[model samples]
Target: MFNEAVTQGDDPGAAAAAHAHGILPSADFCEVVLEEPKADSHGDLSTNMAMQMAKTQRMAPRKIAEALIAHLDDKTGMIAQTEIAGPGFINFFIKPAAWHPVLTAIHDQDGDYGRCDLGKGMRIQIEFVSSNPTGPLHVGHGRGAAVGDSTANILKFCGYDVQKEYYINDSGRQIQTLGLSVYLRGRELIGKTVDFPETCYQGAYIRDLAAELLARDGQELFEKDEAAAIMPCARYAAEKITRGMRADLVDFGVTFDCWFSEQSLYDAGKVAADIRYFREKGLIYENDNALWFKTSDFGDEKDRVVVRQNGQTTYFASDITYHKDKFERGFQKVIDVWGADHHGYIPRMRAAVEACGYRREQFDVLLVQLVNLLRAGQPVAMSTRAGEFVTLADVVKEVGRDAARFIFLTRHYDSPLDFDLELAKQKTNDNPVYYVQYVHARIASIYRKAEANGMDLGGFSTDDLTALSTPEDVALIKALARYPEAVALAGAAMEPHRITYYLMTLAAAFHTYYNRHRVLCEDDLRLTRARLHLITAVQKVIRNGLALLGVSAPDAM
Candidate 1:
């Protein structure tokens, strides 16, 4: 793919002369500066080669353009036109013939048409939804789950060996609170007058966990004194909540290759080993009875404590070990998807990674902002402590796995999302997800109708796709041609929202074509056959995209 992009833009002869004269141009620098076909104000493809060369040549941009144009050749594929526009920007207009082969390529490659090997076989691990075991996942965690999972899929498609992981904050004060909450709830169910503390997890899942414990252990856990029962019940509750969380994430079409336990770092001596390594490296120090990392040296707001005065490790400590362990396992890149609330933690984690002798860039943190879930038009307050928040499973049950996953990933992870249940449940065009899936299903319906009438839609396969020349049809084909470029952009940027946006645009084009043109015209057999081929190609592309997002492309409405 890079070769194709390079060959389509390379000006080697120009590069040689420019290099000899110390007048190397921008065109000689980068292989391709892709221009959006729709944003043609920038040209089919545009480069500031002349402008860049002006600095080296000590000449004006117009002179550079003239020199660059002198070396420009017709070898740039599909380039029907090329000229300098606005301050030495070289703009090119591509011919339709240049784009027509992409349709046949789409048909030949089918769903795999847009996939590329851009990652060059690096192993990347994406860890997300490391929500505590104290409660079920709320909408915020759901958004992180969607972003992380979809990102892993995208990277894998782009030739990265990607591992999807969920970090479980299973060992913490939060889980202890959950255990106490369950014990108190069990005591309450047994008619005790114990007061439930404000810090205890008050979610209904805790109550459910308590009931299950009472039924299974026959009140023996509660019969023991508070000290004896607290830790045991806490472990039990954490396990139960973790199970429920795993099930909910699975139902939401998000699966993790690993469920890393924060406790594991301590249990395996990794935490102490990491702290000792830091201490030996002079990065760790004891101050005010707390062990601190010299994170300030690496641009952190302040030095952070690895172990608090109370002798418990801070989240930073656990995270340091977890990240070290990830690198130890040979993952070339460690990607973490976190909510916006943890935006402050990014600097600290990066500092820790750098302090541990690894390049900070090896750790990529994607900050997923909050999701304001709505029922009708009102914001729904998600309370994890009260356990009244909507679970990912609940959302999937309400709108379906496909709709839930697609909607969750419909926006940039760094931007807050408004997930309205009413909008997602709509079966009409107002629902963006269904609009895309409907295009796939509509094409399937047309084929079925053709089969019912004994007309083989597959019987005609010709190279003359020029027969599909309607404005709408051409529009759809053009959209299809951009899929590979779109995937490449999204993968390179680590942005999955681009795929969602691409699907919406592609779906709109298909809907417009469907409404304006008839694919089964009796008198125009050639045109009909060509249009059917185009629609089939569109369907394949849509289905493949939906699969990447973990959404369904149904064959029927």
Candidate 2:
């Protein structure tokens, strides 16, 4: 794309580049902006510094651009040409050979090529998929799992001290309900006619737990009293369901660094301590026999009750104290990925964090929208059976872990996604995961086929990269070079789905190039080596992209 143009300081990219040219625009030109052009024909990179310097220099914008271009060198053989275009925009065209070193960088870095020191190793804790330990993880939880897990992987890739955590709601009324659900089910199995309350959990898993409870403890559980037995039953059911949740996450390729227990906060009296600290700050007040947190003054919609008249602490109160504990553990940043339904809750949580003396930006809640699972372009009814909803385990079992993870990341976390289970199951190009993974498999096939024919590529070397002159070859190489930029952008924006789309583009370019030309050149050894080296870089980048999404890059379909 270079017509042969001759081409940092903390001060903006345009100013730094201008300083390199020795023709400083006006002293007043303090700010500068640089961006990659939308169209390659415009140039590889563009800057509008001329417009920025116009009023200060009192010169025509185009004249300033021309003067700047006149002093600019060919960026040490990287920039082949520079031109002044629309409204004094300076565009620089980079030579093909300059891009060649990106391939070399990929070769040297390999797995670590797309990584950067963006986070600079700051401690970040991401708590997600903390579904109550009352039922199996349903499809709704699956979306948050994918978003959170992939996000953690990305932050880690970007050089952050990242920890993935799952919070277990092992306290409060829910745990009691789980125990009651299991207890009533146990009575039914023991031939005791008991009316199950409508408020109890209706999942079939609870019945299974109840049957196990009855088999183990028998009438002795009821011999003393239901009150005496309910506590143990609650603990048992919570443990069982939590175990199943962990298993499901493991199956889905998600493993948390910690399983935080809500009960632990209460056990250690952390909530009471946090409340007392707030009271000392004169932020907590007793009203109508309940302890109240004046969150309204801190930007919340209204004041919230931290403790009820009966002395039971609210979930909000415990969560506030839990966040305080998170910061005390030395996490520089705390990110909680919650459901979109909690959008209104963000204000209250932020207010609480601020009232606790932490900056508002220190705590962030990533609200993940709902996912609608579809089959053959129609909605799959996700109603319950035996009190259990259609679970995430069912979806993962049908389409596979890789497909489930990849498809779930095809859109941003905030956007609604209609997951087509049928499309995800397909082996065709319509299935994006299969399409991208196939590129890796195809490259592997090229090497295997070449080696089988006694046309070994030997070791990859780029001494004869000049053989790569075709448009398809150049496009594929260019696409390969964009992997790091894509990764940086995606990680910086916290949009992991962007990486999936980037891989698809790379795969398509590689596929197009492969169909047009051949890699194994029997007559030309240099051409063969060059193509092999290029395709090897392509394979590495594809693998890198796939790895970021927590999906596998298979060598064979």
Candidate 3:
């Protein structure tokens, strides 16, 4: 309706346009945006269409607003009244009947109420939690997993063809270090006096891997040359650790469409091929007896080496190849979720993307910040290198997946999160997940009560919605109407926390409405049925929002 008013206001044949000498041209030049006014007395919805067209129409904003409102086509009687507010803002007071369709649409759509076609099925890949398979996943990795997985869900809900991927850094020096750590532990198990280098991994998991290796391969492993033994140990330990990582992720409700290995890039000769391609494109050159990418030319602070003087490729080389392969596989957009420490790496990666003939905007990186695991407001000690950190599995086991994932997504991924173990487990409103899930449970209880009361368990008709004309009822419906907008914004910005925030807001609104009004009134069945239908829509939307975050909406708290 706001769009129609703008079009009519701009039509040359309209009286307002003729009065203004037909200065207003096509409405396409400016976008018409409608926002709910904070104060109900102001109006139901407000728009700045007049101000937006003031410059284009060569008229004062107040005059444009008057002209627009005079020419508004409220043919369906949707707008009960229109007011010109300060600074030429148009306020619309929509009739009570206008909000009924939103309720009907909610019932018609159900689980898909908030879903949008923003992406139009664009192929997008999101790679996250690519933690090295050297140790168990810590709380930091848990945060990344939640953020990445929820973001993927949001994109998919917005009609994007999204593939969740985990890139395995299962090659090079780290694996070598993992192998040597296990092999040294194996030697100590065999009673051979060996100096355990300080550079070796100190995790207890490594010792466990060593013990398993000794049991599988026996003492013969120690008899082989240390170099030959290290490779076998490396392969065995990486496979085991990767398997455990996969299982932990599955338990956390994050399953990847692909478990891409960094080693595969080398084994398939893609790394070497990428370097040659870059060199052919003059994006790579030799300097200091090493191959360096011209990242500086593409906005990086300095050129970065892809190959060392010792004839070994750096990790950056593999990353370049991996990203190239991602685009080659027909993904229109690629998103990498990395630790906050990798913030500096973004410029270089963007440079590489541009050099590969892709736009800088096509490649995105979501830098997830650190997570501080706390118990009762006291920090829990964690050292990944020393194997003293709390594992993601331990957190999930203690707080459950729903709580952990919800807490992880309560804030933007770029902001550091403090996951309070005690707070997450609480059933009170202090616990965000519990608070939101309770809304669903409470509505289910309402339905059960409605059934027990012998009222028709069958749904209400559209005419019943006219009973939902109270300010509280209108406010609740407006809140429900914002769900699709929240989802669309979240998908556009690639931020899943928006959904979390929306869920909390909707939950609070429902709780407020429930406390003030009785849904199953004994004296008034019409109002009761109307309120029940309203709450039913609320429950469905809450479930839909929670599903996007990979959190469950329980029938009972």
Candidate 4:
């Protein structure tokens, strides 16, 4: 919304450039991008139009910037000053009145202020944390859960028809391993001596499931051969673990529109059909008594086996069918979130998508790197095969849902995260969640104080809005104003960490302003009302952003 001010009122930059050069409007400029300067000394807003025209115009950027500023006069009345900065960057200092409109927008839009129509009505499906239903979700899955759920929320806020989904990997070798694990544990329940294998799951849930199966199925499960009983055990263990995963995700503030079953793909013969289509398209070949996808042709390291010599399909085959099913469901775009270890799968996945008659752009993969759970300063131990990782439920229980989510997303998806458990639980500035939430709580405390002091909370005068002209005040407002742009950028790039970064910046500015200035002064009524309205807007924006990240903006600590 703040960025809209640059183009809506009048041709702010383009008209100025056209008038200066006597060329067509926006003709000489490739693209006029406006952003706040990192340093306050560089003016309020800076654009690179001069550098854009330098190569084509055959002139120094400094000369072009000087020419652009010469034509910018009081025609807009918005720019207070204009100058050419280093390397011919045109920077504009807008009058304080220019930021007043942002307050009106924030007040009027409320919860809807930062929402945009960037995605229009396009349908998008996001699949994340589709971990095989073998054990509880660990902290790695926690990062994916936060990132995926927040990304879906951001896209929906930006007006996309977004569908959040979790694919159940219930039909594979892993599920069979879960069955063997349960089967072995079930015999132990019957007072029979059984040896556990390194390949089988070692989680406590396996013993729990064994107890349940022993009570439900009785000795009947043991009466049948392991081959005949493996299917039932696999089916039962998958359902139990999947239900636990669903419950845990719900508790973590994540929900899915669909709990897609991988077994359903096989039961419906879609996997076979997809293989036939690949065969017909000449995308598959036979080698060493196995069916292989021509993935090497698509820049993969080597050809991949879709069907082994034993006639069982690989996980990649099922994934292709799953994606094909996603596109056939009328989704225009499909996004899958997987761990960074799966980065090598991107090329073949794109190739499969192209073979399914969709462009490469229609499908995307977001690779989430590992999260190193840290207690104090040391690494927390985790053993996936032993089912000994600190579960998402454990993290949520320890730090609260809001703190867990906020800390999980404090870093970008591709970057490795060192999740400091102690810091996440800290109620101090060292904790980002605490810092940002305190800004909101402080604003609420001001409102309570305002009512007690009989201060006007109904409306504020825009004339007094300029009374908040201190550098910290302006910085706080600017941070809040850039929310819409942050949402758009994060959604378009699938980065939820941007929201966390913005919230921290806004919180720091608000904290600085609160410490330095007074919100409800005894002597200055107009200034009091002006700053009250300002902080109220900040509270609204922080809530809006926190809502997207699935975190709470508390009225009090």
Q: Which is the leading candidate under lDDT? A: 3
Give the residue spans of candidate 2 off by over 4 A: 1-34, 222-224, 384-388
TM-score of each: 0.88, 0.92, 0.93, 0.92
Model 2: per-residue Cα lDDT over 127-222, one tens digit each? 999999988899889999999999999889998999999999999998988877787778777778889887888777888898787788776674
For residue 488, model 4's alpha carbon misses the true position, in angstroms, by 1.1
Judge candidate 4 at residue 351 and give its lDDT: 80
Q: How high is the CA lDDT of each candidate model?
A: 0.81, 0.85, 0.90, 0.86
> Which residue pairs of candidate 3 clash?
none
- Model 1 lDDT at residue 24: 34
Task: Give the number of the best model, judged by TM-score.
Answer: 3
Error of 1 at 40 (Å): 6.9
lDDT digits (tens) for residues 1-557 of candidate 1: 12212221334455555545433333344333545545644555667656765654555776666655555656646666677777777777666556667778988898788999999999999998988887777767788888888888889999999999888898877777777889999898777888888788777777788889999988788877888888989999888878989999888888888888889888999898888888988999999999999999998999999899999988889898898889989999999998888888999999988887789889999999888899888987766656678877778888887887888889998888889998999988888898899898899999889788877555575655767644566567778988988889989999999999999999988878888888887677777788888888989889888877878889999
Better structure of 2 and 3 per TM-score: 3
| Model 3, span 1-557: residue lDDT tens | 43343443454345455356423444644676988888989999899978887776666777777767766767788988899999999999988878888889999999889888999999999999999989889889999999999999999999999999999999999999999999999998999998988789998888899999999879998767889999899999999999999999999999999999999999999999989988998889999899999999999999999999999999999999999999999999999999999999999999999989999999999999999889999999887657788999999999999999999999999998989999999999999999999999999998887788788646667788899998899889989999999999999999999999999999999999989998888788888888888998999999999999999989987
